[model samples]
Target: MLKGKTALVTGSTSGIGLDMAEALAREGANIMLNGLGDATEIEATRAGLEKRTGVKVSFMGANLMKADACADLVAATQKEFGTLDILINNAGMQFVSPIEEFPVEKWDAIMALNLSAPFHTIRAALPAMKDAGWGRIINTGSAHSLVASPFKSAYVAAKHGLAGLTKTVALEAAEHGITCNTICPGYVSTELVDAQIADTAKARGMTEKEVIQKVILEAQPTREFVTVEQISGLAVFLCSDAAASMTGVILPIDGGWTAH
Candidate 1:
């Protein structure tokens, strides 16, 4: 479905971003994987995805916390593929702490990676997408984008801003045949979440299972973690011809957390 097209999925070395990249590749889109990972691992992943899917795969190692790096990533993608049809802003991080105790540096880091990085990438990729007269931009938002929780101030703020940005870009790009949307997911069993669960268990003197049940799964009706495949499938749908009319929308795969 996406033959001859190119996709850039940020923070795609692993987790949901990796799943999104693989899904797009399977649809015949050339893939550009971005993230901070070990050098050998990054190259191996690129080679493996290219070999398995029979789609060209490239890598852009950019520290997305810096705007210049974000711009360079777009430049590198355009250099490698000539044109970009899909942009998945999946690069983000979270810092949990009481608002009063949150470190200023951590707040800045979260905002830069989660919110500002997307802005830089969209700004750089929009002109090409507009020139091509077709594009899909998917921002990887969180369940926090719709609802609030304690101790995640920076993450919540960045995701809310990302949803707003997605809407604005969708409106502006509507006439140009480009659609922008946000995919808000519930807690997934990623390395990030694994670390958080471990920390929670240690902090509260609870087992990992107890922490997951009482804290992570409490807000979810399914009492289960959302899978990366589920989120990536939605991304694939959003990038399809069938979804051309869908823009400025925030689709939540949060297991009814947002519904209630």
Candidate 2:
């Protein structure tokens, strides 16, 4: 369905980002994978995706925390793939700590990656997408974007800012045939969450199992982690003709967490 189109999915070396990239690739979209990962492993992934999906795929190691680098990432994608028809702002970072003890540097890093990076990419990619008269911009937001929890001050603030950005861009781009939206997902079973579960277990003197149930998944009423495949499928649907009129929406794939 996406033949001749190009997509750039940040933080796509693994996890949710990778799943979305692969889904777009399966739909025949050329893929540009971005994020930090071991060189050999990332190359293997790039090659494997291309080989399996029979679509063009490339990798870029842009430091999304820097606005200039984020702009360059869009430019590099355009240079490699001709046009960025879909932009997935999936690059993100999270810092868990009380407001009183959250490090200043960590806050800055989270905001840069989670919030500002998307702004920079959208700014850079919009011109080409507008000229082409079509685009899809999907921001990977968190359940925290809709509701807050303690200890994740920076993360919550950044995601909320992203939600605002997605809405504003959607309004501006509506007449230009571009759709912008945020996907607010609940706790997902990504490697990042697994690590957080282990860390919380260690800090709270609880078993890993306990941390998952009582800490990581406590707010998720479903008590089940959202799967990467589910998130990727949502991205695919949002990019389709069926969703062209679905712009400016803050979609929740949070397993009923936001329903409450």
Candidate 1 deviant stretches above 4 angstroms: 202-206
Q: Could you tell me the lDDT of residue 227 within candidate 1? A: 95
Count of clashing pairs, candidate 2? 0
lDDT of 1: 0.93
Clashing residue pairs in candidate 2 are none
Query: RMSD of each candidate?
Result: 1.2, 1.1
The residue pairs in collision within model 1 are: none
- Reference-based lDDT, residue 154, model 2: 92
What's the TM for model 1?
0.97
lDDT of each: 0.93, 0.92
Question: What does candidate 2's lDDT look like per residue over 1-260, in tens digits?
Answer: 89999999999999999999999999999999999889999999999999999999999999898889999999999998778999999999877776887899999999999999999999999999999999999999998889887778999999999999999999999999999999998989888887767756765688998988887777778888899999999999999999999998898988788888
Q: 69-114 in candidate 1: lDDT tens per residue?
A: 9999998998999888999999888776778888999999999999
TM-score attained by model 2: 0.97
Provide TM-scores for the models: 0.97, 0.97
Candidate 2 local Cα displacement, residue 249, angstroms:
0.9
